[model samples]
Target chain A: GAGVSQSPSNKVTEKGKDVELRCDPISGHTALYWYRQSLGQGLEFLIYFQGNSAPDKSGLPSDRFSAERTGGSVSTLTIQRTQQEDSAVYLCASSLLLAGGLDTQYFGPGTRLTVL
Target chain B: AQRVTQPEKLLSVFKGAPVELKCNYSYSGSPELFWYVQYSRQRLQLLLRHISRESIKGFTADLNKGETSFHLKKPFAQEEDSAMYYCALSGLANFNKFYFGSGTKLNVKP
Candidate 1:
């Protein structure tokens, strides 16, 4: 893709429902990241993926929040039994991740989830 | 834990006035800070980073390790500069996961 692309640009689900968000990163980017942003709040770290390495899942808020990346290209974020508090914008980013600490993240348009 | 904080939520300035967006971070090891801007209805994009030490769109941010600050500055503000700006930090253990500040809304009046 030309840039980091996210799917389901807007999702409105009832409480206790499950929702899935998708991200397709820029071609050949080695690092991918997921983040959550509440209305009028800063983005919160969620998860990270780097090539074929095991993903760093430390940032997942809870067990309900899980993400998987396949073939190191596309990633999906799943939220089970979503709560009202789960409503927020989910963002995805990808970086070249070559210069050790010089990784610059480019973000997607973000998915806006509204839990009613 | 690595944390990024942007103290001001809203800032209004006239065109051609000086503007500064304050950002502070707390991390135990070496710190990498970045500034991202989101124009109206546009995706969030990287503006600048501490490592690059380069200015983009006439905006620059300098990392002050002693003060734990990475404030973004511009000598003269333009109407196009009106947008939401975020400060981010990446740490050693976070696998390049960037921690973003609450964000500051810069409004430039014509």
Candidate 2:
């Protein structure tokens, strides 16, 4: 089975520019999550989507950061007016079900975003 | 606030030696813990979860509610075990949101 996949494995953008990172969750997955990994830092929770429920936007760092999951499969994280602080690896993961304890999340290869 | 903590940034062990990676979490409600691993050039994947109480690839973790810890351990380390490991936590009420630690990089030398 195909694992979670992210696009533009690497991206470079100038400060103040906007960029979008895409994620294709595993087929039949009902849960999707976005995280950011900064250099020498832990994975920071970004956003989450479960089935058709309202998305959890609490983890989003700022108003410039936003994500949307369409049809419960594909997710996109968009950062408007990119900043140097936004340079990090954006990771996407998906789980078969919504149970946190029982469902195991599978991660994608991550997109390394660099803001110059 | 829910948070996961990995005390050690790196752990080095010789092949055939015992290995332990410490993880502690703070959560007010019932917590779900998990260990995720990433080998060189590989995407992060689930290694084990506390609720499952199952070992994978010679690794096991015991969750201690009293101590609020879930330390990952293996009887004998293998060179192939070298990789980055993350300890994650999620609350029973907020299962979809995972709080991850900084992660520990393990190095197993032959």
Best by DockQ: 2
For residue A1, model 2's alpha carbon misses the true position, in angstroms, by: 1.8
- For every candidate, C-alpha RMSD to the true structure in Å: 1.5, 1.4
TM-score of each: 0.95, 0.96
- Candidate 1: give the clashing pairs: none
Indicate the docking level reached by candidate 2: medium
- Candidate fnat values, all: 0.85, 0.79
TM-score, first chain, each model? 0.93, 0.94
Best by lDDT: 2
In model 2 chain A, where is the ten-residue run with the lowest total lDDT? A95-104
Tell me the tens digit of each residue's lDDT in model 1 across B59-99. Answer: 99999998999999999999999999999887643554678
